[model samples]
Target: MTLREIMRYAGTLYSANVAASVVTFGVTVLISRDISRADLGIYGLFQAYFLFGAYASSFGLAPATVKWVASGAVDDGEFLTFMALRLAGISGLLYVAAGVAYLLSFKVLAVALFALPAYQVFSVGLSAARARLWRRREALVLVFASLVTSAWIFALLLAHHGYWAPILGQVLGAYSTAFVMIAYVMTRNLPRLRWPGAWRRAFWGTALPVFLGSAVFAIGELADRLVIRHVLGLADLGVYVMALTLFNVLNKPVHMLSRVLLSHFSQADHGVGHAGALEIVRINLVVLPLMGLAAAAVLPWIMPFLLNRDYAQAFPVFAVLTVVILVKAIELVQSSVAVAQNSATSNMRAQVVALAAYGMAVFFLTRAFGLIGVAWAVVLRWTVLTVVQRLDLKRRGVDILPSHLLVRASVAYLVALAFFPIAPWFMGIAYLALGAVFRLWRAPRAWRLAIGRAQN
Candidate 1:
């Protein structure tokens, strides 16, 4: 496929994922409104733990699967079966661990633990859909899963399950998606379960690098929860988690872009480096800030309207995290290209460095600045990460970002942040004016021309 075709596929799925994520985001709104701060904290911890658990156990299998199938290095059935058995064994250990938690009197989290297996199954299947470029199927499955999460949460909330409501809702939605994914596989005729033949080396090559590098990053992503709980207390964690909930809603598009880009980069050999990198960076610079600024514009109203006073304190943290968005948007391009080029260690190294910086940051910043400090520390983590990854890319002849454009995006963010605490309305206006001055939207046309040249 050409770069254009890859981008087109990414666009199609991005639109669909956005529509589905809107419905899913409503579940977050409902949960935040309905639960108390302590309950909210407990719920947030549940999500963070299970999500990390899933990512850790899956061991980058999702991206690895995308690389394998997209590159035509593995048969879909054998690989799928390989993943299922592998995860099944891990699930057994997880179940045992959850049982131990229950015995230790953490009943709520223990029951919620079942979501891990559900997520594993869903990811294994979704990886197949992405590999085959089954865009419509992927979109429909996403829609179905998201709707299930929404409907189940609504039902559970009305039934007064408290924190248990959202937890159970996620468990059910994941299992529901897992069921649908199973059907997708059955339609293709299940391959006889067998050991790896020629694909073993390819399998480990992608999986090990991805897992080793990403595991530390995953820990960093969840570390804030632990820090907040220990230093500030559970209610404070709940307050901070509220900000993350909003951020995740807007982050759906970024996630979609990475998934699609990995497939594209795996297939298209010509635009795998410098020029391809530039186009994606430009696209993210246009989209991420727009999402953050727009989301920021409504927060002064939405926080008060949707949440209680206690939970509404997430505003400052949410605001600071918006700055992180400016940096994070470009990561999809850097990461996808690195993995596609078989340089997952670059990501591994970057994540290690960032996580270390983030640890010290949380230690000092949380003490000095409180929750907002934790938030700024997160911004610091991503900034360090992006710089490290960009340097690695440069060494490989993939200069993913231009200095001027990077500065433009950073300047626009600083302007927005400067005015944000005073008046979010002004922040929006300032960002828009800066965006105009910077001509952020002009990248698309240039990106098209660039891709055209690179593809040729």
Candidate 2:
């Protein structure tokens, strides 16, 4: 796809994603305030398993789906046959593993394990939708529908059931999306249940490294929550989970944007080549700082209002997480290099290293300082990731954007950091104004370019 088409698709994807994220955030705030600490602790424990499931379920099928579909390996019946066999075999084994765990009363582990392949199934369909391109609007619709329904479920559960409500909503939402994906596949007339025929080799060969890489990545993030539970106790785990939820909200906008952007990059001319990579970086620089400023300004009152008054203490955690986000954002810019080079292996390897760094940092830090040390560990990991990836990308001759832009963006971020001590309300207003004016300024040019691109 051309750059303009990519941007257009990204914008649409972001609109849908942002809507879902906002609702999820709102629900999270409510849960954090109302749910008991012990319940939240249970939730956090389960979530680690869920994350592991998410990583495992994909069995690396996501990138594989994206790769083959984009490469036109599945333009006919044979490709579909191969994919169906692979998914069936993988999903079957996964379900067996999940059933065993569930029957054993390993609820957290079971839920997470089952959810992994379930999530992967959903991701594969979503990736297929992107590959098809014409299916983009439909994919967004399914996602939005699932989000709205999930939110409704959560709200109802909160009034009647409390802790179980969020999990019910989460499971329903996940399955709802999965169902939509399956329907999309059937309707598209892709090949269904053909002979397995070399499917294992193709699927396993691609997924093993990616799976291992993702496992490490999962451990990096999940270890923090696990540590909090073990060292600091479940109450602390609950509190930290709430803090992480808020932190996730802070990160979601940019992350959603990044996902949409990456989908485009996956199919980019020359596969997100140097110039395309630079353009993506430029857009991120413009968008992410503004997002950070906006987050800093509004989160205090937002925390109290959305969650309960009890969560006001989470503000410091929110602040630390926001900075952690910026660190990761820098690393993402470098990751564009790995993506463009068609080296998922390299990306996976880098993630492994980052995971190890993060795990070690969290272990020591949490032992010494509790939550704050854990937070610091996150910051350390992000820093290490950025530096390590930059060095790796540079040595590989894949430095897409100029160093000066990086310097300027870093300086801008530092200035925004100065606004933290400002009253939340005032800071929010200022950032809101800044975002408004920036959007207004860009509108006329953006419109003209839109017209020009269309006419061309």
> Which model scores highest in TM-score?
1
- Per-residue CA lDDT of model 2 for 142-176, tens digit only, reads 45655755576676665754556666566666766
What Cα-based lDDT does every candidate model obtain? 0.79, 0.63
State the weakest 10-residue window (summed lDDT) of model 2.
437-446
TM-score of each candidate? Answer: 0.91, 0.83
* Cα lDDT, model 1, residue 37: 77
TM-score for candidate 1, residues paired by index:
0.91
List ranges where model 1 is wrong by over 4 Å: 1-4, 191-194, 270-273, 403-408, 432-444, 447-456
Clashes of each: 0, 3
